[model samples]
Target: MALHLYALAILMGAIMSIYIPMISQSARVMGAAVMGNVPFFFVAFVTSVVIALVSGQRGDSFRKIADVPPWLFLAGVMSAGIILGATFLVPRIGTGALFVLLVTGQILAGLAINQFGLLGVPAQPMTLSIAAGAVLVIAGAALVTFGAVT
Candidate 1:
């Protein structure tokens, strides 16, 4: 199960690497970042409905949806913001810089989430090694984002 999870993570990474560029290009072609999200979410909503129906857990999923707090729905808002921001920034920053910066921000947020057990995540107290690793990641992001152009 753990190996499968790792593989899924890698797969997600690959998909996202392509997904951002596609979003970027679509936004450029459409001449509006916000416009890109219309079809994007339309497909996302349809795909989610299909998955729910096919998974045989639609009832359970709907039941659990009611259990979630209203504030948690802000995640959808945040998702829209993230997608919009990515669409706008990718063309300006280029994919490499955008990805590195995004990963850097995610790592920092992950650290906080782990430390505090935020959003029901398991608490994992920060250690020196973890902090050092975060530092190294930030440095790498800096190099990738601001390094001299060839």
Candidate 2:
């Protein structure tokens, strides 16, 4: 079970590596598409609105303020944090470093997940080995990014 949990965490790290670069590439393409320095961020906002409107519909849907769930409002607030973080961080560090930071952040988040035993995920007690491993992994990332012997 411990090995399985570790594998999932590594897989998530790999996924973050791939997905973040892909998104940056897509954003660059979108930037190239507009030619007028049009903010690529509008793409996300536009899609978000369309998704909420379309997916919110049920077989016999009725859109009403009173029917709106508080959870949806909370989600919107969270989304704001996500978008703001992306805009600020992505431009500064570039996607590679940003995803590296994200993976490290995920290590902290995963520990919290383990501590609380959230979402039926198995709890793995944190240890020095895990902390040392995280430091080593982050160091390896730095070496790969900045090049060794530089």
Q: Give the best candidate by lDDT.
A: 1
- Record all residue pairs in model 2 with backbone atoms less than 3 Å apart, i.e. clashing: none
Whole-model lDDT for model 2 versus the true structure?
A: 0.63
Backbone clashes for every candidate come to: 0, 0
Candidate 1 lDDT over residue span 52-108, tens digit each: 888886677778888989998998999899899989888788888988898899999
Q: Candidate 2: minimum summed lDDT over ten consecutive residues — where?
A: 32-41
What TM-score, over all chains together, does every model reach?
0.90, 0.47
Error of 1 at 65 (Å): 3.1
Looking at model 1, which ten-residue stretch has the lowest summed lDDT?
A: 54-63
The C-alpha stretches of model 1 lying farther than 4 A from their native spots are none
- Which candidate should be chosen as best, given TM-score against the real structure? 1
lDDT of 2 by residue, 28-73 (tens): 6666422212343467668766887788755345346458867667
- Evaluated at residue 58, the lDDT of candidate 1 is 62
Pairs that clash in candidate 1: none
How far out, in Å, is residue 126 in model 2? Answer: 1.6
